[model samples]
Target chain A: MAGQPHYREAHPLVFVMTHWVNLICMIMLAFSGFYIHFPFFPGFMGVARGMHFFAMYVIIINLTFRIVAAFTVKTATDLGSREVDTDIKNWLPQEKNKHQFFETVKYYLFLRKEGVISAKYGSLQKMAYLATIPLTYLQAYTGFAIYGPTMKGGFFAAGTTLVGGPMNMRIIHYFIMWVFIVFTMIHAYLANIYNFNPSKIIFAWKETDH
Target chain B: MAQEAHGAIYDLLAVRGVSRRDFLKYCSYIAATLGLSEAAAPQIAAALEKGAKLKPALWLNGGSCTGCTESMAQVDTPDVATIVLELLSFNYFETIMAAAGKQAEDNIAETIKEGNFILVYEGSVMTGQDGNTLIVGNKEDGSPKKGTEILAEAATAAQAVISVGACAVDGGWVAAYPNPAGAMGVQAFLDKEGIATPVVNIPCCPMNPEWVVAMVVQWLLVADDDPAVFLEKTALLTKTYKDGITGADVTLNYPEYVVGSTIHDNCPRRGHFENGEFVSEFGSAEEAMGYCLYKVGCKGPQTFTQCPVTRWNRSVSWCVNSGAPCIGCGGLNWVDNNAPFFKRLSSMQMGGSLGNVQPGSVAAVVGGVAAAALVAHGLGMKAAGRIGDGPPMETAKKYDRKRMAKGGDK
Candidate 1:
């Protein structure tokens, strides 16, 4: 575990900024998103809507940037090591993650007391993180499909008709919001369960060791 | 507190005795209630000025909850009490009248004999229990008359019939579910009886009293005081169902404007729906924050009514705005379509093992099958001992069960 990312190189400066952008966009999305859902007051309709649409585009852009960086950036090659390798391989697995899927689930369920030993991230974590990419895009798709001017677009309209009606499409859009919410809770808890070291590294862009 | 509308005209007749100021004020109010601009005030004033005595009216009740009458009572402007006294001779209103028994039935008979009166029908026409679901009786006659018979007799001599509320227009809740009393609307019942009078439908649960008053004023004061104009405005959306016994076209048609657009078109939360923010749980932060109720099952997207704008309680508030989602009470077959309101769609009346299942659940289950297949593929890789290796597969063993028993030779 020498040269372990317990100190530096765990997160680069660009990755840190993108993470901040993601967090800010999520907060804005959840807040203004609710305001636009039901206007509690008579006015503020225009402001809430602008904030919602603005934050939505920003989050989308940030997500795309995050994906590209996943391929290009150099980060830790192992869970605790500062050695840099291709980011995708560390995010996923080396050759070791293939047989570890059930073992990871078992570790969480307490079926296997100790955590599954692996190269970097566990299989379940990899799957969950990968799943979020498509989910975010799906939320974006459903959102645009229900929007008025944008809804008239061919692709969004295709989503509309494929779902029978706008109401049905709207429901899909609503439920996906729930997915993000639940995902955020688990993601935040899992990342913070160990220490603020990961948080300081990604958010503050400062190295911490304990 | 105000005077009976056109009470002056009745007062002038000497026999009826009503104040003129009360009469004109009621006319002014009716003019306003009907959404006629201020210009119509003088014309309304002139109509009531000339219209004296009364237009004899037959108010019949069928299989009903009397909610229409209750709704009418709730009319704050020009209150229904004034409209009845000022414009029409309410000879018989069963639920409100002090008259009862043989005398009551006789009064209805006399009203019909007048021949030029207006007919206001509430509730649904009942045909079940051998036509005994609703029976009109007089103490002296000591025998009940079928409701269908009464409607037939009333419609025959009537100049025009007004179908008020969902019940009179389409049998309402009395016709919901099994519809045991064989409930049918007034128009259908009279159609079977062969009555030729025009019928105008005013919809909603109990209907807006203003709409009914509007139709009445149009017939009594405007449309050149012609009865046919009543049918012409509301004829587009209604379908006439034939009444069997009387062989009459008793069904009336309704206006499309009030029901043309879905509630979502005018809903305030509709924007939230488009934005994809939703209240997944009742009383949650999302709900408190006023997010879209679509996820908590708002039928506004499919329901047709001007409720979002027109609202209820003198424009105080409506269902969606009040945090309760729409149940689509205004749509066709509303109970059947809008029930299980907390969910996206209707549930089957299935029992035990087959019980209610949502479309979402069905889709998830079908997706689960695909997930299971993927899991099985993973298992197939494991059994072939391809774990630390990639899934370029070879079906290594199970086919050689006999060779396992002869393993010593191998």
Candidate 2:
């Protein structure tokens, strides 16, 4: 038993709700945002705009709630660890996930096999996740800064002036959306690669107990 | 048949020395032109009656060539439509006003101070050189008066500001790229200064007089005793495209009904567009056939304005109908974004190092590069023995263990 690598199980309820929220929010945001960007049909403009704005507010609220919950919620840390950890800490790095960037790269490049695996996340994964938090906030900020009433306000006015004009700012916002799209694509593909377990836990909220 | 109405028709005909019958006939024709029902003739006749006593309107030339105001003089049909101006009073007009600078300025100031006049503003608002770009009249020292200062004073006490021509709406060609002279349209400039007074925009290179007439009629329809009240109501409808200085919002807040659809929607030559008939070259047989200008880069598809229905030059011809492709002058930042008039789209302004890249082209190129890079990386992964086997486990673990037992924390 001492020789066995530590493995931890996540708190089923909080994780279940969070996973459902994230999946639903991301889907709703993408769908409604696209509809607002261009009305594919005529009758749906008002509806699409309503949905887009509603989704935006909902996603923002959900994200805020999720971030706060991360501190309180205990989730799995290591694949083989019995020690529980704060989900945010696990999502970020502990003392362990450092200088592993190139090593992970080398492993991906097939330079090394049986790469070091310790915590719940590898360095690369942690970074990609952390990076998304800021990028998401930035995308939202840019979006708000281009919004009609918001753009005229002093808060957004500074960003608009800095970027030259609203058009340029809007372009930045658009390009950043593409970044999120690519990120979501890569993320979904990577998460589902090993098995369907992650998808079950995250999307379907079906916890895998071993 | 040509003339014969009451005081309204008589006054209009009187301006050009036409007889009473001729005046009434002209009134009927004008009523028809304005798209009014024939039954509205007596009502129109009554309005003209009240209109004939009005003072001459002032047409002020700012940093403009007064082309639009000049075009206003060209409004035809025995010039009776113009006699409609006799309903109100015009104390001064730059091109034809008998008064000189000081006299014109004084009279306009008096009229505006009384708060009973139509202020017609022409040309771009010059903010370059601290308003030194356009000097309307000289100071006592014989130096020119700043355009901005004069504009502020003239605008503050006016009943209404009618911004004529593209330049007055935005900097126009004069305010093109780099906007060295800091030329901006009347409304945009006014917004910057926090002047909330309403402005009616009549757009075009020089602008059409019919639009002015329509606006005048619209104003007449909703004329109010308090200028401020009228201004407040019109300002609601007079919203400007906030970012015309940049081509961010392509369409300004033009009347939705007028610019709601593209010229492509209402073009007389739309049959050719669907038929795939195109004008390959200028003055070609296809051109004579009035083929669609889409292939030739007609901006009609992207442009929104009532040019097709409104036409130009006495409704005889317009851009596409005249064999000229649409240049999208009605678009915000029209000149900067729509010029290189011969081309379908604005050309990229090339500079050193970076190659000239159009917006659409840049998007395509960047997309292509990322796709190519992804494919190449995928091939590299396969070649490196990483495709079949997952990443190395020992190294990844070693890395994780090292992080878990960290030394220095930031």
Candidate 3:
């Protein structure tokens, strides 16, 4: 297994670029957003706000593009497999992923000695990934609702009123940022826990043999 | 009767050194502020002139600090005396009225009997301790008449109600969090009592006196002393909240012109904000230069008011101009929203012992706990011998295996 052929079918170049965009934009947004929330330093308020809005737009557009690319791009159907399928098939749940949900959880908890055979993404992975789409859109909605100029619009005003006011809406936005931060931390640690091969492939597009 | 009243007012204005021209100019300014056309200025003047009797008004107090009354005294144009003496009859103003004690209490009763007066309410409607928290006067039976009871009776008989300042608008500081005395805004209390009279809310810690004056003029000239017409002409905005006790929706009306735009948009420092200049600390050079205070916790971006345009203290200066950030005093539940006024965000009240918590601290604790959990899980994984490439793979679930064993893999 160690000297087996390295496969490029797992991630195409276009998907790699999108992944980089997601990573960069996420970092920029988190940093600028934190700065905007409470300026830890002086004189960068305007720049921080500009970066936050800019990165927000970029990430939203990149996410939409990536979703579209899923239907067109081809990737490995299973971990360490050379056999390829449309990326969406791997991203969404397949027949092979059924009935192994608890087994995967048990394995992660060290209750099970053996791993659970599943698709490219485990059931838990798929759920977490899917949850992000709506969460991202919601963050944007809350953001616009808090912005001064846009908040006056009837659409944002209705939301602001429903949540009670601007302060509550702001708290919702702050909590969602923590969600993203924790997601990224777990995602990074788990992706590199076993080895650096996954990071190499995603970041450098360099294939690794299992 | 109308001509004599008109002459009397003119004579009073002349005696006070406010010429008819200066008075008309002031009227036009008020008309503009109320979102009325210039033509309405003459209508306002005519209304004041032709009125046979001065409109009776009750300036009542509840749980107040009298800051709003102080602000009212600072009205520069026609002055407080002109408003009380000439425009409206000050039958029951506790702060400035000549009457006191029983005589002051009698003025309220007499005004209520007349039944056409406007009720100007200041401070929160205290409903704590069975309304015993605030006692304004005594009833005929010698028992104390709660401030709430007096307000209820006066509000019922009034032609219109004006809720002045943050306390009367939404309970101000007293209603912040853990509101022990059960303080609530006038509108909420009125809704609880099932009173449907329209209330014009002028919000701020202490309301802008000019705004109050403008609203009063609007009531007189544009609405022709009609409450329904006043609500109609003012372009009022409504916010609905579900009543906690009744489970019914209570809709409150606010003037759109005052609460429509953010202070940030109209701020003079907005240019500095766009240019990325900011005052990081008080007494800094940037503050001297009058840079944007966004970094120093200016709630201007979220606060809706014309403070920058209208200014304060007779339009000489305002909060931001005085090197202080807006605490968002115009917002609903302002004390809760704008507390820790020097910070970017309001702290959350965790109740009882924990008190207020910051968002950043909450995030840090969550992240720290997750990191610790991951570290513990890693050790467990190593002990289970499933680290390198993970544990052995299971092809199917336990249920799938049982189904195949029972009959067939259909």
Q: Candidate 1 at A151: error in angstroms?
A: 16
Q: What DockQ do you compute for every candidate structure?
A: 0.04, 0.13, 0.50
Per-candidate Cα lDDT values, in order, are 0.66, 0.63, 0.80
Candidate with more favorable, higher TM-score: 1 or 3: 3
Write the residue-wise lDDT of candidate 3 on A1-210 in tens digits: 112234678778898898899899999989988877866666677788889899899989999998998898888877778898888997766877788788768767767765666777788888888889899989999999998758878899889888878877888899999999999888887776666677778889898875
What are the runs in model 1 whose C-alpha is more than 4 Å off? A1-210, B1-38, B48-52, B74-81, B84-86, B138-142, B233-252, B268-293, B308-323, B348-357, B369-410
Q: Give the TM-score of candidate 3.
A: 0.91
Off by over 4 Å in 3: A1-6, A72-74, B1-6, B37-40, B74-86, B241-249, B375-390, B395-410
Cα deviation at B89, candidate 3, in Å, is 1.3
**How does residue B53 of candidate 2 score in lDDT?**
59
Question: Which is the leading candidate under lDDT?
Answer: 3
Weakest ten-residue segment in model 2 chain B by summed lDDT:
B246-255
The number of clashing residue pairs in each candidate reads 18, 50, 4
Candidate 1 iRMS, in Å?
12.5
User: Candidate order by TM-score, highest to lowest?
Assistant: 3, 2, 1
Per-residue CA lDDT of model 2 for A2-81, tens digit only, reads: 11232225434666676576667677766666544433333444455466567667767777787888898777776645
For candidate 1, lDDT tens digit of each residue in A47-156?
76677788889989988988888899888756666778767666665665656677656544435433445555667777788898899889889889876547656788
CAPRI quality of model 1: incorrect
